[model samples]
Target: MAVVFDRPSLWQRVRPHLRGFDWLLLLAMLMLAGLGLLAMYSSGYDHGTRFVDHGRNMVIAAGIMVVVAQVPPRRLMQLAVPVYVLGVALLVAVALFGISKKGAQRWINLGVVIQPSELLKIATPLMLAWWFHRREGQTRAFDFAVAFGLLALPVGLIMKQPDLGTAMLVLAAGLAVIFFAGLPWKLVLPPVLIAVVGVVLILAFEPQLCADGADWVVLHEYQRQRVCTLLDPTRDPLGKGFHILQGMIAIGSGGLWGKGFMQGTQTHLEFIPERTTDFIFAAFSEEFGLVGNLAIIAGFVFLVLRSLMIAADGPTLFARLLAASLATIFFTYAFVNMGMVSGILPVVGVPLPFISYGGTAMVTLGLALGMLMSIAKEKRLIQS
Candidate 1:
């Protein structure tokens, strides 16, 4: 016993706790981190202070990832209810007396002006997973409805704040939980059907509903204009459609092999807006071209696949649901950024995960990655 207690190797202690470490996932995460740094450096070249700020955020994010990876899923489950409740309360706070920015109030100052919706991005899934896990083996239709109500509550509040993008993200994260919880396909099909119909209706009547200088139903005028601009960017080439046009030009200008790094005329000339944030992909594409785009896409695919594998191997229902939701969230972030940069979607404020320059988003993504490591770690422990 004395021999065992004397100077035990650090690996011995870490080995037992990290039995579920997925080396593939770790490698994928590291690859993404490297890509993030490269992209940040290139994107921040023209903007002083941005490059250094991005580096600081990266370090903070890495530290968060390490800390989150250590927490057991069981502890995550325990914190779910409180986190959700607090998130809801914060959303309400945002609705009332929140900080206004660019014609939207999506923040509140609690010694700092922070976006509470980001917290819900993580808390919503954790809470819903806990709820579904509680009803395991006996999940009924009403229970599912109640679960959706729980899901919709925060989404409704977020949408009320007119933060359509974050609201969609929160909604997606909750639905992922519902899907992983094995909610009936019948229930799922209806909402999807309604959404399709709603989109079609919007497009069909877009001209009358979105005509210039017309009042919109609930969406801000700029939001409606963004959608209209997506359909016909050429109509207002030098106006609202400027962003889409510039992004498309930058992407298309990059040939099969690209013009070479930092050689993009549009990017260097500052045609692309938010080059370090939402539209950073355009800068990357301009610099690296098709091959670079493929590489970035492949990296994203590997990350998503690894996350799904982790979800599949999680030791508990909560871990599985949380992992799957986070995986989809990662996919959403990539999809929105790519879609906007390629002119297929509206230029919302969605940032490219890990690569975009924002401290809150960086920390949020880090926390998600950390949770993934925790789930993977638990799975490894079970396997051994």
Candidate 2:
């Protein structure tokens, strides 16, 4: 008689790993992606292949997310410095010999046009999270100062490129990490208060501050115009105001239940500018109405909340900060896109996450979400 032993099959061996997956987050992402596909199809009807391309991008992003989730947080922290250095080097390269498109030199020609700022959106937060993680429990005010310096270097370079949208995203992501790392309120409040006061002053004396030939001290002429347009789009009705006006009109017309999917007059009539990109929110609002808007908002809320919960349960300080920061990135994208489309914020070219048709943004988002998944999985593995 011979004793025989059977080895476990591949599926059986891999099944344990599958148990660590976060289904809730996966569901929320799928819901948002589905809604995005619907919106892109409607908004990009006349734009040849946009709907298909958007789907392709989503698939690619999902694949990136899956691949990234497999890399544990420790490995991610190890790569953080290298990634940050590469991103900054690319930004410097862009400054010196970057490709210029539409009056903005924000991309580098590496056989393909690549936006370096996009890389920093994830890398900056990762670097900060890793930095604070190394100094966990012994962090001082001086450490925070060093972190801010780290944050400022890349942010300043991106701002010089004059890509306000990408700059704002990176700034928000870095600030989220700083805030989660427990930066004192005294340090945080002053800048926020100053920003509020500045906004009030700008609105109070819009006619003067925005008057012709008035040079805004820190903002470029176009940036100043965007702020002024946000305050009063009607001032430049046929010029800088057109996009805001059309967006507001589309949103207002959506009413309660939406005009019905693919039935938006503003969208189909081509009145909404950048329907496949920055202003896609208007097209969505017009067709989906208030109900649809609420649904999409709910999806984003779930995603953010889930990520925050993951951050709260993260096993390491780095994981916590990184997860929270990534969550804020998603919230910032949604809020800015919606606010700008509704004429309440400046038109900074921020695209609605998932819904907007953009390759770089989609890839960045996928990476952030993947990192969140990695943190979540790490926590799960520890608990098990």
Candidate 3:
């Protein structure tokens, strides 16, 4: 009886899970993570435990990514609705009594302090993809309305919290899903044209619009200040413009070849504010310079392009839309962070994916990467 039994080897059992894992996607992520550690060590050396904490957070995010990757994309569709509902409920709770830090009420403490807006960054796309999935092949204008309605709720709540950065992220993810779900170009171009015109108007009337006590009827006072600061950081060099001014200095000082690893004067002199977090891109640019910046950008491009390819080949419309939206999330994070640091855009609460120091942002990115891997794996498994 003992001789009659045959057992599968451990490799045989684990091999199935490994079969379709995307090595190229993993290579891109690892490359970015390596740069993040390098940048964090240089910029956060003097800051108490920031470097150590950043490494620990990366490990945690990797663990999350591995765990999430095990779940099939089909399972994600089942979760889309409930996860979104839970996210919205938590947002409402935060609105009622969330923790406020530096005048932003974006966190809530259940047991451990948490930010609900982060959940919507992923959930909005998931919900939207799910909506379009249900309505696929029978799509209509009304269906798009329902999709936008789903998107607007959380965006409005996040804006009410005045967390423009997170709101922008959520909005971008949702819109990406809707756009991929076959939104018409006719509906898209008007808003695009309007925003272009508005930016031009603001620049043309900068003096009158930015004058002290100028009333921008729609924009909040701080929002107006951010716009004006982007236009001219010199307006209040030692005041409201300090952060942007410092960022530009750090970026420009890096030049062709960076100052040298851990030898950035702008970074070490404490001129670059938020050097470990939001503005880590500037710190990285200071030490690594243009060449290094190009490498970092190349990594992101690889990740995004690979993600979109996976989306294009997805077996289901849900998978396609979800993957595409998540892909856009990466692009938006990088674009917005780099734009703000280079003084091309107003500063926002966005992080530069793996290159930024933040446990929450890192984990969110990890979750997204895992989902993409799952979708990629699902396609391969089907072929096999």
Candidate 4:
């Protein structure tokens, strides 16, 4: 007797067993991390200790990414409430007993001094995801209002701490969750339009009103000054506007091709402020030039697009929302950094993801990537 057998396709055999697998997400993350190390090598090449610190942070962030990737999306949702509640509690504690630095009280003492706001950077999205998951298939207009409330609670506290930059980031991350929850354009567009108009009104008439110092509504004096300074950076070349002016000069100096790595006069001469932090892009642009900038942008675009694909293919609502929010965070970090560097946006102290030398931001980014990995893993499993 002759028997006929059909062979299974590769996807059919592999699809069902991807519980903790996400190679594409992993690859994209590693690529960004590699770029980060290259940038850091140049940015901190002169400072031995900083170079070492950057390496250590990279290791730590990698560890976080691994641990987060192993956990399933269901587990992440289970922890969301407690983490977010504790995060809020810490923010309140920060208000009462936080360490003051750079004119803001935004840190707390644990076994080691740490910023609770950084923890909320991850928790905010987690909580929002959990909330939407609970209300799935029955969302109302008021549901979004409630989601905004969840966002505003932490954001309001952070802003009260007068940490405008962090507050904005937290806001963006939480809003990402809402956007991924399938928020209506009617709900989304109005707030964004109002925000734009409000900003324009503030900028168009800030100087005249602020000159008299007669109780202007909203925005602290320093915050207002930052916005005005962005409009005309050279107005106070050696004062409040110096950072923006220097950043633009450094970026422009690179021309078509950079002066060459470690050969950037602006970076090596220390004309660029916060070269290892907020303005690190200027250091990078000065060294690598426009061609290098395009490469970095392409990498970001690829990473974000890959994330969106994972979200689209995710099996569960929770996984989809988490992946999308993580992608949005990537976009937000790049947008804020480039905008501030180019003087189109006010200097809000947002770190360039991966490139900036900061433990908190790197860890937050790692966790975000891990969430995407979880989503991708689930999608793979579902396909199987």
- Score each candidate by Cα lDDT: 0.87, 0.94, 0.92, 0.84
Per-candidate TM-score against the hidden true structure: 0.93, 0.96, 0.97, 0.91
* Candidate 2 ranges with C-alpha deviation above 4 Å: 1-17
Ranking by TM-score: 3, 2, 1, 4
Clashing pairs for model 3 are none
Which candidate tops lDDT? 2
Candidate 4: what lDDT?
0.84
What's the true lDDT of residue 51 in model 4? 69
Give the per-residue lDDT digits (tens) of candidate 2, residues 1-384.
999999999999878656677899998999999999999999998899999999999999988998899999999999999999999999999999998988899999898888999999999999999999999999899999999999999999999988999899999999999998989999999999999999889878989998999998889999999999988899989999999999999999999999998999999999999999999999999999999999899999999999999999999999999999999999999999999999898999999989999998899988988898899899988987
| Candidate 2 lDDT score at position 140 | 98
Clashing pairs in 2: 258-289
Per-candidate alpha-carbon RMSD to the true structure: 2.4, 1.8, 1.5, 5.6
Error of 4 at 205 (Å): 2.8
lDDT of 3: 0.92
> In model 3, which range of ten residues has the least summed lDDT?
1-10
Q: What is the lDDT of residue 32 in candidate 1?
A: 74
Q: State the lDDT of candidate 1 residue by residue for 1-384, as single tens digits.
A: 355547779998677655556788778777877777787788788799898898898889878887888898999899999999999999999998999997888999999889999988999998999998899889888888898899899999988778878887888889999998998788789989998998898789878766767787778777888888998898799988899999999899898888886788888888998999888899888888899888888888999999998898888888999999999899988998899889988887888887889888888988899999999887776777
Evaluation by lDDT, superior candidate among 2 and 4: 2
